[model samples]
Target: MAADTAEENGDAASCSTATLSKDLADLPQDVFLLIITYLSARDSVACRSISRAWHAAFTSEDASLLLLRWHFSRSRETRALVSGWDSRSPGTGRESIAAVFAKVARRYHHLRQAKPRLIEKIDVVQEATHRDLHRGVAPWDRILRWNDNKAIFQYSDPTWCMDDGLLIYPGLDGGQYVAYDLETQRRFHVPFDNADKTVRRVRLACGVLVIEWCERAPYHQLNEREVVHRTFATAYDVQRAQSRSSSSRSAKLAIVRSPSDDSSAWTIVFRSEWKIHFLGLPLNATDRFFSTHNGTHYALYIWQPHRSPWGDDDPIEQLAVWNISFPSAYRPSLDPAGTKRPDADLGPSVIQRLTWRELEIIGLRQRHTPAIRELAMDENNLYVHEEEHRWLAGTQSSIFPPRHHTVRCTGFPLVGIGPIWYDECCADGDVHMSFCPRSGSTAGLSFADADAEAEAEAAGNRAPTPLPLTSYRKSTWPGYAPCWRHEEFPYLTVSDMKDALAGVRVVARQCFMVEALSVFVMPRISIEADEDADADTENPEARFADEMWTELMGKGRIYGDERWVVGEDAEGRITIVRF
Candidate 1:
């Protein structure tokens, strides 16, 4: 009987081993898919190498769609494009849904890694006059000249704007602009007849091109000798222009194409004039201006420095908001000969000015008054960086080299014109403060140092934090959260880093003195990692930022989209990297 029990135990043990060693490929399709849903996009793709069965399952249509929805569903454009894709019937020679998903995933992977498959350089000096070209005056120089030779502040109008594969920049003559399509390799000329007007800023978004230009107008008072500067904004239909140009080019194939062929392409859909001054002070070069649009609504932000009523030397900053209709429902013909009405002051009829005192009263209750260091705006809110300086105990009288600084961020909602509201429980809930060792260092402070300082101070250790040579928030008011929050690198100084919100990723281009420029593509949030967890651990956000950051040899304004990064090389030529 004992021998029989032993034999039965041995047989049962062999059966259990067999069950444990069963191939993962033997799992049911539903079970396999469920497991895949738990894996990241990268891991799911890597699993194809496990076995032929795993490969087949991963490459299946259902798996591809599932991964896409799970990983890349943040991009509405991607969702819309992939919605109609039918893998079972991809048509005669078209690729399957799985193939398309692979291609897209690989593209985004390359983008996240900052690895581009192709880089193209285009010379925008073609239209520049011979004299200007000989004098080394490039298109970028002309843009600065248009802005009254003022240094382009972070909040100032960009030198150029790129969107939807279209790159728009000023031509040599200042009377015309060039819209180059990256996909079609075609150039469409957008020309204006006003010789006295110069394009100050150009913004392209949502299939519409908005140009802000300044023209010399006669002073309202005849006795006043000062020239009146009037700013006007005009919106053109970019899609309509491209379509018209394509049709015209195809019809005139036999005839040599010239700038005239595309001159009529751009149609002025909307036009309005904006006030150039506030509170009797003319808007000067020091003032900041930037415009943004979200297809339907177009908004403009202007930061002007005003003298305090109390006669203090420190100027009180004023931020003015303007919300204008992008494409007016009523289209009135304003052609030279057509009926022309007085330039309508559509908005800005009420300018909401927020001062530093008002900001302090609203939320930021600090011991020392802080100065606004940098400003950035999106379609939703305006981001402000405020810095307060503190002198060391023994170095109070010293003028330089030894001071502690504290930096914080404040976000104000961009609601049209009304009283701003905030959460009573957490009025300064969005406020995040960090300490810096160096004083007046504009190069930017790294978060590593901030993290260390916070920890040292939290431990009840009053020891002075060591300074290295480098020195390199949430609110609830409807749609009024902080504009950006990245775990790896926070508090990007506007002076060195240029950032753009491209769908799910924030593409930041940082300029290093020795490295030229480095591009970092960061996701808004990590899928596999906890936000509150320490970044030193095996955090995907930290790993991705470290791995994907790429340095390029260039020094110019940086602009990018989901797939491409466009900047100027050392030679001042426009360089585009396609992933």
Candidate 2:
């Protein structure tokens, strides 16, 4: 009798299996892809083990592309690289799609979890050359001040910029520049005649390097009444320069120049004198001076402090925008003196100016003076982020006062055709704001207390636990409505870290933070924080696990892109973290 009952149970199990198979086979392609889109990448990949029909659907190109687009819609770089793979090649079977999907999924999973597959460091200043440059010069003579009996080196804030996967910075000798391609692991050195000047800031984009430098006025022209220094911006074309293999051991010892000795390697496409004065005061004394560029458009933003000459008048601050067009051909005749010609029609043009009064008239009413926190630019629009601080009456205060923070984004079109728009969003004082240039989006953290009644109704009398929330807003065009979303992020928050936050990016609905020494990636959506879960534990086929690099601890001045995080260590080394 027991054997008969066991036989009946076995038959029932077979019937259930047959039913699932038939149902999966009957599912339409569009419906199947739609269902897969809702599942996580790991779960979708694991669905192939269910049955032949399930495996076929999950392995199809249509399914893979759908999942990639849905999960990584905000990541244009990832989508561009993954979508170019052809799964219909000769030896590649239908399973190729699944394999590619799994690989891409794992890559981003590592990124989101702050686990890098590889960590590489490159010394910006060669040890031998560093010693040679400081051989005879005293620490005080080289702009180094002694604070607390320790030599404090004074230099620009961000001495480097990363674009198109290349880390470009001024060479220590000031006669050359270094370009290290993070992807190719190759280095290129472009020489320029910056012998007598000090490089204040460096920017690179679209194979062109824009350098801002200041030099002492010629002795013959120097006087008490005249300006003591001159500043200029010069653009160099370094696209065709020869690159050297950086994989060799000797490459790490010194900056090596390429074999090409082309005298015209420093093609000056744009050169203009930059006036450092604003409102009868030197701009270096102002609140902020920011400059950025896309391949086609260049933008310079200056935000001055609020001051009132008349005590009874309201304080006035100014923001000026300069739009410079990059011409493909270099024109020597237009700029014969190597200075900006005011009479010339083709040069940097002041397109827009916004003052405190004008901003107030445009509905950005502020109770306290606003400070410019960040400035970003793209091909079409220039974004200015302003924050106002107001102390709260009753709140727990830490190192910083508990205050309400408000963000206002004023976007201006580069082409000067569309109406200028302004959007305002507010966040709790504790939230750290981050901006993404690629998507024109801003994200921050928002915290709320748990609703006891709702938690009891859902969890059946279990105690409620607070959840951390992420608030995101995308900048919209003139005629479109703004996009905003609030999602639960159970992984980490701004208050949890002790290091200074450098940057933040939101991809695939996951928050990634670039901190001084580490990259913090938010985990997948879950109600509970699973400390034991690996980065790719959900995917059984994952090739790598979560990795931590303690060597990256002292690296500050952090920056990141879609796949790499670049930081500058205390000893002036460039650390690249690849996921």
Candidate 3:
């Protein structure tokens, strides 16, 4: 707890200002409840002077506690006090948002006497990091909130649709898809095509529910090639809930002009099934994927691995994009080799879905190396913002470090890469320079300390109880969320990047860090364990034990459709990436 004192010399400005007007003169309990819920604690404190009745009501244990949470969020001593209260009925603990405000106000009253000085902490490091426009104290969230826009957007899960623009998230347990218009205060719920809770999975169509589970995808070949498999489920306008499973595998697709009770009003449209073709194998990594949909065709671009897959440490020497398209399912030209397939007549015909317009910005690449951080498209010069540690800037060269960079696009002879992936160009570009975010260890202190002395004297209202030392638990996570972090990008560079590169240049270079986990997901137990070992050979599961054990020695286990890409570059340096 922080020591505070609010003697007779306290100023009125430090108190709260929650007030009620003539409209709320009567000030019903419910109305005051609303005031406590919405008004800031500073504002609420001033309301206490309104009347004796108001003072008694706001000072109640419930009201004060709520106010405490609203002010300080969490107080270890308060929590401890609350925990000791009798579980059967509320105890005499009076800590809440109201309590925190009162306590804090008292501290400000005393601090007015002593000079509270502001200090700037300078971090003098020999390495370069991301741009630090504002002092370290500036809000970091502003980076994501560019243009003063909200960084986080809340909405229903994006997938299904029953109307035009708005889509409904499917219910987990046979729930209807509800559409809500916050503007007009209108809401609508769409019923499921079938009532069977068993057949719950669905694929959203233009504006209807296409009940089905995700199609099975083919596993990568031993060589780790790109495999594209077509969907197998047939489409339909409406599907009657059939009691049987095997027979109902097909979908209905007929349209009923007028409403009727007949289930046959819907007819089956067509079955879907795609073919297999390899993309960049584990060796040739895909850099980026972009695609566009034209009226009758679609074009894609795939930024792909540029060099011969031979070593582990080699970087992409250049950038390249491929050209491909998807026309109607009736087009034979859409085949992987442009050869006629059984369903070629239903496929798309043309390639290159994007025109020169929609994809205005494309040519951002660093000189054969340079780890990329942020990329945004704009007109004029495509920016290639970069951040390299100051240490790496001079004597040593870094393969990766706490750096950020940008690139721009100019006119070039380009083409679409593949379906769903855009590789508009096939060339390497020059090197560029820019900076990234700082490597400072950031921490957010969430729990607050109560101003003990001032709190005990504030408003002359006694604390009723004393506080204890040692309040809250320690923090577990120190860095950014792994998911939010560009896992491949580096954060700290106390050492030079060039030094790191040279040090880890050999095969199997690994790095690890502490990650605060809200929930720890255990590694799958399904790893093929020991079967009866052929005593002469090895533990059936132990055939490759040493290799797997070596990888697991220090690496954090990551799963969920996990596959590792180990691409050997020309220099024989191998880069192992797992996604």
The global C-alpha lDDT for each of the candidates, from Candidate 1 onward, is 0.44, 0.44, 0.28
TM-score of 2: 0.51
Give stretches of model 2 more than 4 Å off. 1-78, 81-106, 125-156, 172-175, 190-192, 205-209, 216-227, 236-288, 302-320, 326-343, 351-370, 378-381, 390-403, 412-420, 429-557
Candidate 1 weakest ten by summed lDDT: 136-145
Candidate 1 global lDDT: 0.44
Q: Assess candidate 2 and give its lDDT.
A: 0.44
Q: What is the TM-score of each predicted model, taking all chains together?
A: 0.52, 0.51, 0.25
Order of models, best lDDT first: 2, 1, 3
Model 3 agreement with the true structure over 1-579: per-residue lDDT tens digits: 122334322433334233323434357766666566555455567777788877777766556655554333223223333344212111122234444456544432222221112211111111012111101111111121223332221111112322221223333333444443211223344443322221212333332333322112333443344442221111223222122111121111111011122221222232232221133222111333322221222223333334456744333333222211222333221344545564444443232233223433342343333433322222211112223322133112354533232221233333434222122111111122112232111111111233553355365542223223232221112112111122122322111001110011111212123122111101111011113322123111101112322332221221111112122222212223221
Candidate 3, run of 10 with poorest lDDT: 496-505
Let me know the TM-score candidate 3 reaches against the reference structure.
0.25
Clash totals in order: 3, 0, 85
> Any idea how many clashes model 3 has?
85
RMSD of each: 13.7, 13.4, 24.3
Full candidate order by TM-score, most accurate first: 1, 2, 3
